[model samples]
Target: MNALLALILAAALALPAHAMPDLVILVRHAERAAEPASDPGLTPAGEQRALALAEALAGTRVDAILTTQFRRTRDTAAPLARAQGLQPQVIEARRGGAAEHVQAVADAVRARTGTVLVVGHSNTVPAILTALGGPQMTEICETSFHHILLLRPGAGWMQLGYGAPSPAPAAGCL
Candidate 1:
């Protein structure tokens, strides 16, 4: 009887301690200049899409906002940031800070009780996801508008959610 009771107690205690965050949102910066040599700000269509994405996110629980140190990324997060009344926290991954940034974000997520938003560029987005350490990520070529990627945690792990941006209008065709 004693051995059986101990086994049952151990089994009950083996359950996970904490619930992983329900959402890990990944959003690509809105559209920018076609010509790389020119402006880095969002194009008109990108701006429109940003607004649409913002509206789409309205009333959702966004506990935190993270972004890269780029204009397009900052612009992409502005609407949600404003609505949440929280300044965007820059991830600073490019300045030889990828490891540190990843650790800091992991710590933040572990400490938090709800969803966290992270906005990144085409280059560093996959790295962030990879650092969270569930599976390898494939490079994603981003275009169109309102591109959204979501991540969520599961049985002792986390996984990705991916979606392409909505198609641009005919007038906005490249």
Candidate 2:
């Protein structure tokens, strides 16, 4: 983690004045349900988790919410968006093209000022963090839905947990 913080600090220091965002909070979509195979929404527990997410971020004045078209991602972002009174900007998550999608989200985030909340999938969250100038992150465990990656451009970052703790990951998992 110290390595990551060092990298984050180095990246922040290297950024030009105009490029730094006030803050960027990135997380994997809250726990998903078992219905609709195409795009499942949140479960009852997930709903609670979403509410917990809103509460956890209540102190931060969020300027924007970014979500994908999938129901899970949108659902994960809904509570916070409602609390902040801002419509989530849809940055489409293209299948088989995660790199492009990651870059797009990172670019959109950098273009914006103030706080930005990004609700992404397990597959994308880590990459997005790295794109946002943090270290390369490990994949979030499939059952681990409670971690929050907070980035303060030109300052530092923290990994926090929100809501009920998720079940433990398998050995060697992140």
Candidate 3:
């Protein structure tokens, strides 16, 4: 009886000891073409910033990536996607600030990946955070650098804050 009880207790303790997702990176699209008439592609500065962000995340284990269906957002995630050797999974652009889009990505990340990066826009990034069960006011400001937001499976989420990734020395400017 004593041995059986000990085994059961050990299994129970080990259950929660399994690996959990560590980090979720939320990035707003970099500076876009000044004129909306030209279509929103990342500007030269934006491209430089994207490359810098990718370099900063080189050491992280990025299992998956998510982005909206926009040129700037896609371009912003491109470098990181290439570094991870994985294609960015573009979530359907949210219509009417829908929650389903956020839940779908969250569910996919929770079940399939250990770490996921989501690229979004200035207007909707905050909404995405809220939809992911974060606070309504969890605002990760739009910046050239990346913002690391941490979310546990069962526990609440928190913003791990920002990482500054200026353009590489060879690039000369950010």
Candidate 4:
């Protein structure tokens, strides 16, 4: 009985004092210009939105930032990364199959403490969120650039607008 009691106490002590909720902030890369190159950089408005994103998240304690290899995603996350004194880690964007990449990112996030920000394209944002155990969301529209999706694993998810509120939805468009 004493040996079993000791084992129980040891196991209890080994567990974390408190489990911290994982906070994942996912955003779609800011507006991009229609260019001939396969990967185009951000436009002037996109630049402003990027800065606005930095300001919006300045108060939060972001432990890490992740972005795809593309310029647009990297550029969108640059300001915040610089402000937080963190270099954005480059993750591969979904090409053929995103399941592996998404699972890898989700695992990395689960192993960390504090908040994490992932800047991805409109098409990949929803997939990332889903992989992180968040709700399924529609693809972000080309013209909409201000949606910020906050995911707390085991808790819930919420969508908030940052920078400039997305232009009022077009008529007849939900």
Candidate 5:
């Protein structure tokens, strides 16, 4: 674990001071409508949740946003990005599996400084959190979208919830 943190920190050292973040915020994208499954956008409820996310972090200084190319992730990040007057950097989900995707996102994040919000899918969020030096995390419940995973150097991980509470664990997805 020490070696991993050292490696992550070493990679981050080259970035400018303003780009070096003391905190990294990771979250699964908000809810999605059932139609057009390939690249579904946020549902009305999800939009509200996104706004809630923006409001939740309004007081904090977020210097950068990272998101996948998917519509749901982009839409989920939109509110916060707009609120901060920053564009969310879109990292393609890419082929090669979850580890590859996680590395891509993690590397992109390491290159920047300041606080950042990474909008990833349920499957990706757990790995991304771990890569950012947070604790090992299982995927959020499929129905879950309210979890906000916060990580800072020497701070470990803290889980917080915003917007509507997630429904109890059940089955399937939209």
Candidate 6:
């Protein structure tokens, strides 16, 4: 018994002092207006939602913020970036493809410690999650604005709703 206990203690002590934190938070851009030019900014409700997101994540130790170049994505991440005192890094969302963008973002996140927040669009959120080795999920609906995806590589992923409940899906919708 003494020998076994000594061996376990020695192995534990040989590990690193601290393991890397693999946390990634993903959210789709807040709601946008119907009447405006292409790439219009967030709507009033969307602005409020963005602020709500900041409040929700205020206590988290965010090391980085990533977003696409679109106004909606940048605006959505602005509040949280300001709150965390980190500038949002603009990565090409659709440069090569969803998989390529997601791979790059995942690589960047894995290389660092602490948490990361990525503001993406409905079409790209699932791709990001999938790229990070998360389980497949349904695409974010057009009317769904409150989905918050929490991903921890090697652990798992969870879908959380923040701010207000997402609007009901259209009739006969999937």
Q: Per-prediction TM-score, please?
A: 0.66, 0.87, 0.66, 0.82, 0.85, 0.81
Give each model's whole-structure lDDT.
0.66, 0.90, 0.67, 0.83, 0.87, 0.84
Q: Give the per-residue lDDT digits (tens) of candidate 6, residues 96-118.
A: 58777877776666656788888
In terms of lDDT, the poorest run of 10 residues in model 2 is 13-22
- Give the Cα RMSD of candidate 2: 9.4
Residue lDDT tens for model 1, 71-90: 78788888778887878877
Off by over 4 Å in 6: 1-21, 170-174
lDDT of 1: 0.66
Query: Of models 4 and 6, which has the larger TM-score?
Result: 4
User: What is the Cα-based lDDT of residue 150 in candidate 6?
Assistant: 94
Better of 1 and 6 by lDDT: 6
Give the per-residue lDDT digits (tens) of candidate 3, residues 21-107.
666666677767766653588878888768876886899888988887778888988998998898988777666754676666556
On TM-score, the stronger of 2 and 5 is 2
TM-score for candidate 6, residues paired by index: 0.81
Clashing pairs in 3: none
Candidate 4 CA-lDDT value: 0.83
lDDT of 5 by residue, 48-160 (tens): 99999999999999999999998999999998898889988998897568899999988888888779899999889988888877777667778999999898856777889
Candidate 3: lDDT over CA atoms? 0.67
Which of 1 and 3 is ahead in lDDT?
3
User: Rank order by TM-score, top first?
Assistant: 2, 5, 4, 6, 3, 1
TM-score of 5: 0.85
Model 4 stretches astray by more than 4 angstroms: 1-21, 168-174
Q: How many clashes does each candidate structure show, in the order listed?
A: 0, 0, 0, 0, 4, 0
lDDT tens digits, residue span 54-151, model 2: 99999989998999999988998899899889999999987799999999999999988999999998889989998987878788999999989999
